[model samples]
Target chain A: LAKTTQPISMDSYEGQEVNITCSHNNIATNDYITWYQQFPSQGPRFIIQGYKTKVTNEVASLFIPADRKSSTLSLPRVSLSDTAVYYCLVAKGSNYQLIWGAGTKLIIKP
Target chain B: SQTIHQWPATLVQPVGSPLSLECTVEGTSNPNLYWYRQAAGRGLQLLFYSVGIGQISSEVPQNLSASRPQDRQFILSSKKLLLSDSGFYLCAWSSRTEGPYNEQFFGPGTRLTVL
Candidate 1:
């Protein structure tokens, strides 16, 4: 398991773009970067995942530098509904447990 | 098309009472099941995980235990509840076929309050 560090919280307004970065300096070669979103009183939902470079989905985009030391989650045209905690994790294949940090509390203001 | 279910959306039990929380998954077989606990204002803590029936791995040593009786059914149990056990419990499943790169699907979760 690779330890991740992220901002404790972030604030943004509607229609704005929000970017959260996570640092995993000790990331291993087999480790992949994954992101999850968690709303209040609900289970965390998968947002995006990537091994390197960039990967985009219907919801968000993940960008990883060549060094793979850190990654960023970019959300476009955010709304109030986007308010949630964002978790960035680096994990190897199936057997190892995931180490979750406190996560970034993203508050999308009206 | 896969879905996960957790029972007793909310529970309140007195100290020293027995506790059982069940989680079941549909549309998937041989899935890896996990139990996680989140304290108020904290991140998730992995408690236990099972890759197959009759096999379980515990990440932390504490008062709780887990069981996997069926391929997609996982259970979290404790013989006697303690106040410290009060927290939000979540159940998650991932496809073993996807190997280590699989993304986990989480259930709605169970909120337990031990007084």
Candidate 2:
């Protein structure tokens, strides 16, 4: 399990792009970066995952640098409903243990 | 699509009372199941995980215990509840085929308040 650090909270307005960065300085070679979004009283939902470089889905994009020491979760055209807590995790390929941090609270203001 | 179900969306238990929370997954087999607890305004804490029937791993040493009676059914139990146990309990499942990188599907969650 790799420890991750992220912003405690962030603020953004509607129709804006929001980028949340996570730092995992001691990331392992077998580890991959994953991001999850959790709404109030709900389970965290998977946002995006990547090994290196970039990976994009309909919801968000994950940008990983060559060093893989950090990753960024980018959400485009955010809306008020995008307000949630974002978690970044680094874990080995087959490892079942997921290390969780306090996460970043993103508030999308109207 | 796979779906995870957790019962008793909300529960209020007294201290020293027995506790049982059930989680079941549908449309999937041999999936990895996980039990997590979230204190108010805090991150999720992993309590237990099961890879197969009759197999369970405890992450933190606590009064709570977990059991996997069937492939898709995972249960969390405690002989006596504590006020510390009051929190939001979540159940998650991920595909074994995709390993750890697989996206975890989470249940709506169970809100337990121990008094």
Q: What does the i-RMS of model 2 come to?
A: 1.3
For residues A1-110, could you state the per-residue lDDT of candidate 2 as single tens digits? 36889999999999999999999987878877889999999999998889999999999999999999889999999999999999997766645557666799999999
lDDT for each of the candidates? 0.91, 0.91
DockQ of each: 0.72, 0.79
Give candidate 1 misplaced runs (Cα > 4 Å): none
Candidate 1 interface RMSD, angstroms, 1 decimal: 1.3
Tens-digit lDDT track of model 2 for B56-110:
9898999999999999999999999999999999999998876677788999999
Error of 1 at B103 (Å): 1.2
What C-alpha lDDT, on a 0 to 100 scale, does residue A8 get in candidate 2?
A: 96
The CAPRI class of candidate 2 is: medium
Candidate 1, B1-115: lDDT as tens digits: 8999999999999999999999999998899899999988988888998889999999999999999999989999999999999999999998897565679899999999999
Model 1 Cα shift for residue B70 (angstroms): 0.7
TM-score (0 to 1) of chain B, per candidate?
Answer: 0.97, 0.97
